[model samples]
Target chain A: MDAAARLFSERGYHGTSMQHLGQALGLQRGSLYAHIGSKEELLFDVVNQGAERFLGMARHAASSGEPAAARLRALLVGHVSTAAQHLEASTVFLNEWRYLSPVPRAQIQAKRDLYETVVRRIISDGVAAGEFDPGVNVAMAGRLVLSAGNWIYTWYHPDGALSASAIGAELFDLILNGLAKEGPA
Target chain B: MDAAARLFSERGYHGTSMQHLGQALGLQRGSLYAHIGSKEELLFDVVNQGAERFLGMARHAASSGEPAAARLRALLVGHVSTAAQHLEASTVFLNEWRYLSPVPRAQIQAKRDLYETVVRRIISDGVAAGEFDPGVNVAMAGRLVLSAGNWIYTWYHPDGALSASAIGAELFDLILNGLAKEGPA
Candidate 1:
């Protein structure tokens, strides 16, 4: 699965073939059939693997007994770290996820929605607790947070100067602190 | 150019052929050569077109002589609104931009860097003027703003009940105001 992800991310899905996957692992084409049915299956495997990591992070954060802000930080940081650590899988999920079959796509989307719902819940709690501003729209805020986290796939390299944790902490500060020179930014 | 963008974004670069493009516009494959010389030209044409829009927006904002915040708003709102309006071209810019040849790729990249540099200068000036937080990281913040604006290609739908300007305004407020439920969030 790791090899599959690495290959798929480095070379696009269209650029990869069953034969290439076989060659990378010193296995013949026929042997690969024992492990996977087809090309789409490999793509699905990589997507599923990446989705699970993100889902687990969200679930853990939601279940944790932290305050809303803390939970949000955990979720955001977990997402950034996941993207950094599993760059290939993360890239595949962020970029090639549209290639899944309808059923698999629905399943993957449900997981994604589940993650968003968790973020929304935290935002809701934040608003209710007056920890967040009343004007913060949950759906839009959820999308924004998800965008900020997921878009890390485009630039967050493990080999990059800033570590994932450092980026996460800084983002946490920015989100919690805002950017405005005046009031909370 | 718009027709090519629609075909390429709806399908993909490698997934699109000159004949497919020809078919989309009801033209014979051989005749397409009269206007478009080759497959690579379509990719470059569409990318170059989108880059021009983005660079135009950035140029306008940088020259507006407004305060940093107002100019930043113009930069953000202009890019996002234009992206939403030209859905197909925006998608090509976001997703299929990698298909350009080395020389043209460098050109596209240069335009992209210029756009980023424009926004970075705004943030830097704002920070220096004490209108933005002194702690602001101009480059990272500019990229974050760009990423947030670009991901609209992945999820936004024109008929989905939200207007482009409204979405841009909401996003601008969120990024400008931030998510923190704290002293300044």
Candidate 2:
């Protein structure tokens, strides 16, 4: 999967083939087919797995008993950590999913929208709870958070000055303070 | 340039060719070359023009006599508006620059880095002026702001609920309030 993710990330989904995947894996093309259903299926698996990791974390965070602020913080941490851990898959998920066939593409989009909904709910809750600026655009705030988390795949490096945890914490601090800025603690 | 940008955005840079671009513009392959030097040159032009717009705004904001917070707000508005106005060009700039030959790629990378440095300077200034949390990571905070602005190209729609100005304003409000949350106005 990692090898496939790297290839897809580097060469793009349309540019990659079953034969290429087979070559990377050092398996015969015929043997590769026996093991993996098809190239599209492999793409679906990679994209679906990446989406699931994110959605699962979002669900857990949203379902938590904590306050909206803490819940949002947890969501950021989960998002950053997951992307950092699966950087290549996350890159493929972000960049290559556009090439997925109609059915799988819609499925992935739905899953993505679901994750976004959870983020929106957290912001809305914060606004309602008087923990965030009432004037805050809930949709925009949600997108901002997702953008911040999603884009880490582009720049987050393992050997960089900050660990993934530290990066997540910094993002949380920036966002939490921003949303809660005009509100009373 | 617009034609090239749309083509590149829809098709991966590698997947696109002079024939594809020429067809999109209703030009013969030979005629296209007569008008435009080469596909790489077009890519560089598209990417360079986009970067220049972004960097121009960042430089202006950075050099302004306004307070760091206000300058940052202006920068967001500029970044978001430019991105919304030229979504395809911005998308190509962000996603397709990777396919540039090494020399042009480095040139683009340098411009991008320069834009980032301006953003970082703004954050550092805000911190120094006690207008933002002193503990803020300048580099990370800058990236957060850029991510929020850069990713606008991905989801921004001209006929969406918000106008480009409104969207920019919302982003500014989010970043401003977030960064200045702990600071006294």
Candidate 3:
């Protein structure tokens, strides 16, 4: 699975062939087919695993019973950590999932939408509790958070200066406090 | 070029073939070869065009003689608008540029680095002028800005509720002001 994820990330889903998978695994075509159904199956498995990881983190954070801000922080941290730890899978998940056929594609899309909804709900809760600015655009705020979190897969390295959690925390701080010295004005 | 960009974006650089490009353009292989050298050339052309659009926008913003915040806003808006307007090319540029051969790859990387530097300089200037929070992590903040801007190509549509500029402006407001009601806590 890891090898498959790596190839998919490097060569793209359509570009990676079953023959290539066999070579990567050091298996003959017959042996490879004995274990896996098709290239699409591998693609689906890799993409599905990634969706689950993201959705799992979001779900855990949503149910953590923490305040909205804390919950959001946890969610972002978990998300970045997952992407950093599973870099190849995350890359394939983020970039190649669109190639999934209709049924599986819809399944992944549902999970993705659910994840966004969870993030938005956290922001909405923050707004309702007066913890976040009442004037906040919940949807846009949610997109910004997800965007920052999602793009980490492109640049993050485990051996880099910052850990995944630290990256998430810094982003969380920026999202909550902003860049302006006076905050807004 | 448009057909090539669309194919490259949809099928990926490695997955797309000369035959596919020829078919998309309603040209025979001979005619396709008459107009283009190879798949790599098309890839480089598309990626380079996208890079120029992005760098052009950032350079324009950087040289605007405006305050850091205003410059940053113009940069973000221009970045988002470019991505939204050239969705197919932007998608290929962001996702498939890595498939370029080493020399062209380095050229793209250089432009990308310059773009990041431009963004970071805006934030650094803001901090130096006391317009932004002195505690801001300029690198992370720049990544956050670029991440938000880059990810728009995945979801933006010409017929969407908000125009590209409006979406960029809303994100600019969020990035500058934050979500916390009382700011930074």
Candidate 4:
């Protein structure tokens, strides 16, 4: 699975072939076929695994029983950490999932939408509790937060100056406090 | 060019072939060769055009002479608008540019890095001018802003509820005011 993730991440799903997967796994075509039903199955498994990881973290954050602000921070931090720890799978999940057939793709999409809903609900809770700005657009706020979190896989390096948690903390601060000096003009 | 953009965006650079390009353009392979050198050339052209569009908007925003807050808003708006307007090209540019051979890939990378630098410089100037919070991490702030901006191409629809400019304004406001009502914890 790690080898599959690596190949899918390095070369897109369409670009990676069963032959490539077999080579990466050091298995003959016969053996590879015995292990996995098909290339799409492997792709589905990899993408599904990634979706589960993200959804698992998000669910944990959502049910943490913290205030909205704290929950949001935890959510963002967990998102960044998950992507950093599983960079290859994250890349495949973000970039190559579209290659899945309609049924599996819909399954992944549902999970993704649910994850977004989790983020949105946090912001909605924040607004309702007076913990967030009254005028905040919950939907857009959720998208922006996910956008920042989802994009980390594209550029994050394990050896980079900032750890995943530090990067997530900084992003959370920016999202929570903003860049404006005196608030909105 | 439109056909190439659409095909590249749909099938990805590696997944696309000269044959597909010729078929899309209703030209024979021989005739297609008369007009272009190779499939890579078309990919490079499409990706390069997308990079140039993004850079053009970012440069315009960077040089707008507005205060940091306003300039940042303009930058985000322009980024969203460009991606929304050139959806297929933007898709290819963002996702398939990595498939370019080393030289062309480096060219696109430089432009992307330069665009990120433009974003960073805007935040830095804003901080120095007292329009933005002094404690901001300029780099991470820039990434957050760009992340929200760049990810738009993935889901933006022309007929969506909000126009590109409207979405950009909302995102800009979120980045400026944040979701927290009482500011950072």
What does candidate 4's lDDT look like per residue over B100-142, in tens digits?
8999999999999999999999999999999888999999999
The better-scoring model by TM-score among 2 and 4 is 4
Q: Give the alpha carbon lDDT tens digit for every residue of B1-185 in model 1.
A: 88888877876676677888888889998888888878888788889889999898889988888888888888888878999989899888877787677898899999888888998999888888888888877767786678778888888888887888788777777777776655463
Model 1 agreement with the true structure over A1-185: per-residue lDDT tens digits = 88789877766676577888999999999999988889888899899989899999889988898888899888888888989988889988987778687999899999888888999999899889888888887888888778878888777766778889778766766666656876544
**Least lDDT summed over 10 consecutive residues: which range in candidate 4 chain B?**
B176-185
- DockQ of each candidate, alpha-carbon based: 0.59, 0.44, 0.85, 0.77
The reply for model 4, stretches above 4 Å from the true place, is none
lDDT of 4 by residue, A1-185 (tens): 89999999998888888889888888888899999999899999999999999999999999989999999999999999999999999999998998898999999999999999999999999999999999999999999999999999878999999999999988998998888887645
The per-residue C-alpha lDDT of model 4 at residue B23 equals 92
DockQ-based CAPRI category assigned to the predicted complex of candidate 3: high
**Which pairs clash (backbone N, Cα, C closer than 3 Å) in model 2?**
A178-B178
**Deviation from native of the Cα of residue A162 in model 1, angstroms:** 0.7
Best candidate, DockQ-wise?
3
**Where is model 3 more than 4 Å wrong at Cα?**
none
Full ranking by TM-score: 3, 4, 1, 2
Candidate achieving higher TM-score, 1 or 3: 3
Interface RMSD per candidate: 2.4, 4.9, 0.9, 1.3
Candidate number with the higher DockQ (2 or 4): 4
| Every candidate's TM-score, chain A alone | 0.94, 0.93, 0.97, 0.98
Residue-level lDDT tens digits of model 2 in B1-185:
98998988887777788989888889899999889888889999999999998898889878889988788888988888899888999999988787788999999999999998888888888888877766677887788898999888778988898888788878777776752223222
Model 3 lDDT, full chain set: 0.93
